[model samples]
Target: MRVLLVAYGSRGDVEPMVGFAVQLRALGAEVQMCAPPDFAELLEGVGIPLAPIGQPVRPVVKGVVTGTAPMPAEGLPQRAAALVATTYDAVAAVAEGFDAVVATGLLPAAAGARSVAEKLGILYSFVAYFPTYLPSPHHPPFERPGRPFPPEVTDNRALWELDFETMNVLFGTGLNTHRASIGLPPVDDFRGYVLTGRPWLATDPALSPWPEPADIDVVQTGAWFRPDERPLPADLVAFLEGGPVPVYVGFGSIPVRDSADVARAAIEAVRAHGRRVIVSGGWADLDLIDDQGDCLAVGEVNHHVLFRRVAAVVHHGGAGTTTTAARAGAPQVVVPQMADQPYWAGRVADLGIGAAHDGPTPTFESLVAALETALAPETAARAAALSGMVRTDGATAAAKLLFDAVLTAEPQQ
Candidate 1:
């Protein structure tokens, strides 16, 4: 079986699909992952074939990357040209050979998925990074500025993140202008205009609050599979052992221009509470100081493995990273910058799993108190219970759901 996995985003986003592709390969499926072209090495390194994309991988690294202000509010054009060059070509090249198309969130490949499915009369499936097109979510809306817009209405906070205006030009005027070029209809909405995969394959249903799982085929895969790895880094090991149960601090790949300010606040709070600090220095740069005894800096370590040893985890609240701590039964301090981050931060607090930190205006005393509360007897017990519940068969459930869909669609050849 040949399968195409289409997805894009930071390491956290692309990494999951890579894992999924590997699993599909183990099942005797030839897996080609369509992600940013720059991601070629990592994807191929993991043994998943690359369907390279044209766009630069969102310069998540800093001054070396994005020319414009590196905000999450990006349009389709910023990446569309690259998608056409890389993802489109990759799909077009293999549209004849692939048996199934599996698309991950917000990628042009969803359109490719539909095109291929129609061409070959094969299966087209979609997996979500967060809730892209599902109905009302169980968790708080990531960008619910207006009472969670209905699916019928487009241009919600999420849709604005895409290039709707240009999309209108292409699907409306352009398609109408050249009807004979390809049989394409005017898109319904820029985002959902693409051929959709099956609905969300989230592992845990408790987190998804959408009633009836939308009309489209939907499966929930809560937490994804945690990859196996070696022991913790030597620095992390020594830091954890020497510290008085440090607070784990890191914002995966967020770039706060004032890294020192955030670090200083975290350090002050840690000292106030008399706890050591482990900063994960994600994509942000924080300079080192000599006086801090309880503070350690490490990067690119697996949160799933590391959060287990920490007293509490502080981060920018990416879904994958937060879940790692959430499932580890550790409390969280979420310092969200933008996008779905604030939503997850709020969810953590509401679920009694963590607290949200307003950047620059942190109430150091109160936050320290919350940190203590997170470690309290009853709070710890509740967090443990939530962790157990979240240990929903992430990868296994997702794989089973995908395989089941494939069998139902194709009857195994």
Candidate 2:
């Protein structure tokens, strides 16, 4: 079978699809990816053919993180329309002869991919990295700018209804316009059309379970993760061997505000607990607080391996980072910035695996307090216990499911 995996957004969004693609190839299926060009190096290293889609994501994300970008409500319709058109063109250009197109990431892009699959009469599936993207009475939908729910409307069902309406309002025109141009029927309900009834939830059930008795019949595939086999840098290895295990701090792809301040607070907090600090200079570009020997700044390394050696993982609780830490049995201090981060943070706290900082910005005192909980012996024990339960074969499972679906649908000779 030939498959096209489409993902658009940040590294967290694209990395899981890479894992799924790798697994599909291992299962003897041909796989290609359509994602932002920011991950070209990552894809090249893994040897997956990439069809670059949309603009580079880093500058856009950096703009949002640093308050230089337009607000979410500013010209959203234009942006949404352009994104849909871009995605459609990118996917349609290379979609011929493919058996399936599995899409995840931003909704607008997914909608475009689905439309192309429809036009080509091929199979299409939408997968979400978190449960919040799926409509469920268990939780309320995320409030969008210029579309806040009424004060009196607290019911989850009602809020979800509002969510659908918002989706239509934001994306319907663009989707239908493109559909018309492509000789396809208009999509009346954008959300329903994009997230079909059986959208796959690619999250670890042990860490982020879909609540029972919910609205949609979600296909809960465990988190799609690719094991990182890159050995730690020589300097990092020396740092680990040089001292007692240090707290590992990094915000992954998030462009954290006041990075120097955050780095200082993290270093001080780790020092307060008598531990060293290994700071990852992700998109935030975090660095050592004061050229101190106790703290080290690094670029991308193997989180799967580094997390295991850390005293604790302090980060901006992205789903990928949180899951990596959980799998490594490393306690966490989750400082949520936006989107699904707070959800992951809450999970960490609820599971007794770590501490959830109250908000995004971490003061010296707050970091110290959160680290106190993360470094606790009980937290470490719980983290270790949970590590044994995290499924590492999510990509393989999802790949087999997709392959089987294709095989079953093929007309018998």
TM-scores for candidates 1 onward, in order: 0.79, 0.97
User: What number of clashing residue pairs does each candidate have, in the order they appear?
Assistant: 15, 0
Q: What's the alpha carbon RMSD for model 2?
A: 2.0
Q: Report the lDDT tens digits of candidate 1 across residue range 56-125.
A: 5546445423234543434434444334334545666766777777776544445544554555667776
Residues 1-413, candidate 2, lDDT per residue (tens digit)? Answer: 99999999889998999889889998899989999999999999998999999789898988877788746785787788889999999999999999999998889999999988988888898999888888999988888767778999999999999999998988889888888998998878899888887888899999999998987778888999986789999999999999898999999989988889998898898999999999889998899868779888899899999999998999999989999999999999999998899999999999999999998999999999999899999999999999999999888889988988788873111
Candidates in order have lDDT scores of 0.61, 0.90
- Kindly provide the TM-score of model 2 when superposed on the true structure, using C-alpha atoms: 0.97
lDDT score at residue 199, model 1, on the 0-100 scale: 58
Which parts of model 2 are misplaced by more than 4 Å? 410-413
lDDT of 2 at 204: 94
